[model samples]
Target: MRIPLIAGNWKMNGSLALIEDFGNAFSRTSFLSNAIDIAVIPPFLYLANADEAFEGTPVQIGAQTLYGEASGAFTGAVSASMLKEFGVHYVLVGHSERRTLFKEDDAAILAQARAAIDEGIVPILCVGETLEERDENRFDDVVLGQLDAVMKGLSEEQRRQLVVAYEPVWAIGTGRTATPEQAQEVHASLRARLRHYDENLADNMRLLYGGSMKPANAQELLSQADIDGGLIGGASLKPDDFIAICHAAG
Candidate 1:
């Protein structure tokens, strides 16, 4: 049985004051016992503070991004090892924004995934197709290509330690969400691809649906068989909504 994981990706958001308030509110909530695993990925600067803030709680802290190198003079990069030092257990890699804005290709994302695994940090690898590709009926090929690049140098064990987030590029932050069936179809396809790589790993791995996920539609999305959890965006910023999503997972 796969445990549900509801993760918040606070992309380029939150201040120390906001983090403090969020933390306080989170601590006061009555989360279901081990029903769902809740994680928050804040900006790199606030990780240590978030970790301290969520102390003694089941809420885990994650990083929005991390460099492939463990320690380097790369000037402005936070490595996986450095993130581990700050108690980060998960790292978001290959987000759609990073792909479109920073031009991060599969090779770079794969390297980051490998580095995160080496340092024992779970990498939430993002893969999806753009609206044009979907319209062209080449969505499968696009998503598969992205996953193939990352799976190239990884072993079955390493792959199992990683999580995959399928955020349809066109839907992310666009106020449009893939219908529950649409999201499940893509998720099932992803799981089938993983099964082709390793059956055991595929069965145990958690696949999250990102892109405009919120409390309102969370129950419908979470009810799908292959949809293990979510890689939440805008709705994650609020304490009540995020907590509601977690409860929906239950």
Candidate 2:
């Protein structure tokens, strides 16, 4: 069975003090079982501080974005190797914010994923459909299309070392959420597609729900046969809420 993973995407949010506070609160949390894994995706600037704060804890540190190339004149770009030096074990690739705001296409996202994999980091590949695509009945086409773009390039071995998050663009940060059934359908579809590549790989890959998951809906969502955990946004900003979701999962 795949271990459930609950990851928080700070997404241009939080500061050193916030990290400190979160670290303290998380350290105080005693109910989170070993049955699930947890991660915090903070902005690159706070990675070191986060690593320091969460050191010796089970919670993993992750980055919100990263560059494909290892080293270059790319002044502000961070490389996977650099992230590894800071004890980062996971990174977010193809997140909706990166896809929509920064115009990171599938190819570019794949490059980042490969970079993370090369550095022994787990790139939590974010794949989902936009409001337009969902309303127009192209959810599967758009989502699967994005998945296929990268799946072909990754070998079976590489495929086995990955995680996926399905964040419906329409539901993210809009106070709206995909119903349990709605989210399950896309998650199952993703697993089915991966199964075609390699069943064992597909089963090993943890699928996370990223469309505004919170304590309120975490249990129902986690209860889904295909749904494993969450890629939390707003709720993750608070340690209480984040751990509550983890509690729901545990």
Cα lDDT tens digits for candidate 1, 101-192: 98888888988999999999999999998888888999768998888789867986798888999999877556666899999999999999
User: Any residue pairs clashing in model 2, and if so which?
Assistant: none
Q: After superposing candidate 2 on the true structure, give the runs of residues whose Cα lies further than 4 Å from its correct spot.
A: 31-33, 173-176
Displacement of residue 52 (Cα, Å) in model 1 is 0.8
Q: Which residue segments of model 1 deviate by more than 4 Å?
A: 173-176
lDDT assessment of candidate 2: 0.89
For residues 1-250, could you state the per-residue lDDT of candidate 2 as single tens digits? Answer: 8889999999889999999998898787765456889899899999999999987667899999899999999989999999999999899999888998999998899999899999999989999988878889997688988888778889877887889899899885566668999999999999999988988888888999988788888999999999999999999999999989988988
